[model samples]
Target: MSTTTTEVLAFPNIKAIINDNGTAEVVVAGNSRVVPVGETLQDLRDNALALVVAEAKTLQRPVRVRIEDPEGHGELIVHPDGKVESVSYETRPARHRTAAPASTPAAAAVEASDSAAEDVAPADDEAAQQAVAADAPVTRRSLKETSFLVSAPVLEPATQGWRGALTRLGFRMNPSAEELSEREDIRTVSQHWPGPRTIAVVNRKGGANKTPTVVMLSAILARYSGAATVAWDNNESQGTLGWRTEKGAHDRSVLDLIDSSTELLSPSTNAAEIAKFVHHQTADKFDVLRSDENEEGDHEVTAEEVDIAHQVLTRYYRLVIMDSGNTARAANWRRMIDHTNQLVVPVTAIEDRAEAARLTLQTLESRGGHDAELARNAVVIVSESTDAKRSMTGDALKRAKAEAQRIADGFEPFVRSVVRIPYDPALVNGPIRYEALQPATQRAWLAAAAAVAKGF
Candidate 1:
């Protein structure tokens, strides 16, 4: 028979600090290292685990490490066989001590008896100390309230980029920092609120990318959240939202919806009935309610009609994104602002567009009520120049990028958030679809949507 003995190793202190800028500083035994791969809290933990596992392998023994992060403090045990286990401790609340009441004669007698017993049986000191500890006034919270549970399933590694390549070759490498950040953005936009929410996309200048912003935001939110979202064209007369989105078989518009608002708002109306006025984007998983596309129609959408259409849409869909016209003072546009829970201002990199966005915000602020509050909490999205094509020179593209950054910076102080979207020819024209967007463009839109979601 053969006998084997294994030794256990321990490291007393390992600290991981996760920063808001998607980086982590790890300290091990007074030595610190910055890990660039800590885009999420889970990433920070995995990086700490990898560091301890490597040391344990070299020492040929199981190791234990005390890990602390912003979330909580815990301990991790790494075995030489590459297995890891975690033990978490609950936090104890502060103990408040009040003056003890005068002890009764019986209590004094019991205490005297206990003191004599303790002195007589000195070998039971450890047990006596444990009893004292057990009676202490320490209130422990639940483990869930103090720290993350290690028993949760680990997420699979990346299947893209170099890590993905290694994964295909059976190397089992974790995802990169960029991939983890993207996943976090996706999770942010893929949330459901308590009730219906409306986002108004506005800019007083033509060619400010309002329509495309509405379409892309709706598409991203719908695709990621699986929620019923609608992009409504709130133009006074003729709007291009219908021209740039898919059309239904009957060519129904918001006018038709206003006409049937009574039936749609009724409790007996089925969810499918609202589809008659909406054009569903098959690939993007969202619906588009177009403006009055009839060339000969002389009627404009009035404020009352806007209210009716909005009530009907809100009854049917969980999210409604309104695409506004160039006029900020129009009745329908003002009504849209009244119904808005979140305000999004879209601007191209052009100077004129940027100025118009600033003016629009100022106009809203002058109203000095819900409009002013919306202006203060609005999110501004700056898109690069559409003219900078692949055939353009590097210098021109660089200039375009510089202009977009300038516009983004100008609005950052006034708005809650500012997101920059790169130029993509797919977004320049034609019916927009999420699947048709480039990978970089899609990621940019996803981030933009997440920023907007934060307002909710």
Candidate 2:
């Protein structure tokens, strides 16, 4: 007498296409459904696994799945009992392409297999291999050609808000949605681009918060990304960025940097030598290239000087945030716009400031070419009035909020993004430090910086 081996039957294979926009298109037995999966490659993988496992349990059989994402392609075997076995996984050299949708032949084969599963006998190993070969695309790599190097699942422990409180009290909990969003914002600002980028902060009116916007963006980006960043006062004359930030060892200004641009730009020049002209913020982790502050001097920075200074700064720093003068028509201001990869207009929530910001963008749009493009993609930051007081009556506060909302709404259609910053006493006076900002204000700036980075 001979003993026979029992074969295990599996349901039709499932296909999952993971998209970069935080959603997955899951194909099951020729039917397609789009599911809102969480952001990140790991999220797509886990959610797809759960969906396939649920289908396997419904059929009371194992199921095979093929997953393609921006990262790479992989295959898995899911058992009805919630066990998952990785068959093959390979990561691409670079995350360049998203997975394409399931093809017609593959869908038809999947549908046929699903309909025949109940009536057909359990398939042997050889037959199962043949079925997979017929359903999978010919371009897919064979099992022997793929690697089985599996990455361990990463679980982020809650470290913020109520979820964090539960975690600290000996309970395991996932991060809240708010915390997850904050994490994504942090990730966005922390990324390093391929090359140096320039951002111009302009409003063409005095006291429009251009200086504050430049300082805050530079500080947030530098503090998060840990990259070299410089805030250059691109004013025609006597800009106040130096008065608002920490002082370095020397009293050097942009004039001094321009005088030595040739020496600094020399291939043999050391990177640290250029630091003599920039003032480092002790708390903000960024440098400030101050403008000429001489009370007796009447000299204005010219367009040619702006080019030379920009060249030197770009050579030394990965990011440059330029604070413009009140005159949008000035040669230096026009040149700064020419060099800007991202345009930011910061307006305090006042009628004149908002109007000035609008006019400034209109001026750029009128110039056409790259100026027009920059104006179209500019990020407008609307800040609440610094005069807002906690002691004010409820109606006064209500009017202030309504005005800010109105100003923000005005630019919503014309620009790429409009961010509102709350009134903070820390930003009103003295040297602006990232640590001095309120928690809410800091979060808002982080969001603003992420918006700026997306333009890069």
TM-score of each: 0.73, 0.73
Predicted candidate 2 versus true structure: per-residue lDDT over 1-456, tens digit per residue: 211112334346489888665667779978986544555778777777767766776676677778898778887777765687767789978743334444655565555555555455676545754675576655553587434453334548899988899999999886755676688899999999998999999997898898889999999999999989999999898898999999989999999999998899999999999779999988888999999988886999999999999999999999999998999879999999889999999999999999999999999999899999999999999998876565666899888878999999999999999999988988888888888899999999999999999999
Residues 201-227, candidate 1: write the lDDT tens digits.
999999999999999999999999898
Q: Which portions of model 1 miss their true places by more than 4 Å?
A: 1-114, 121-153, 388-391
Clashing pairs in 2: none
Clashes of each: 0, 0
Candidate 2 deviant stretches above 4 angstroms: 1-46, 49-155, 388-391
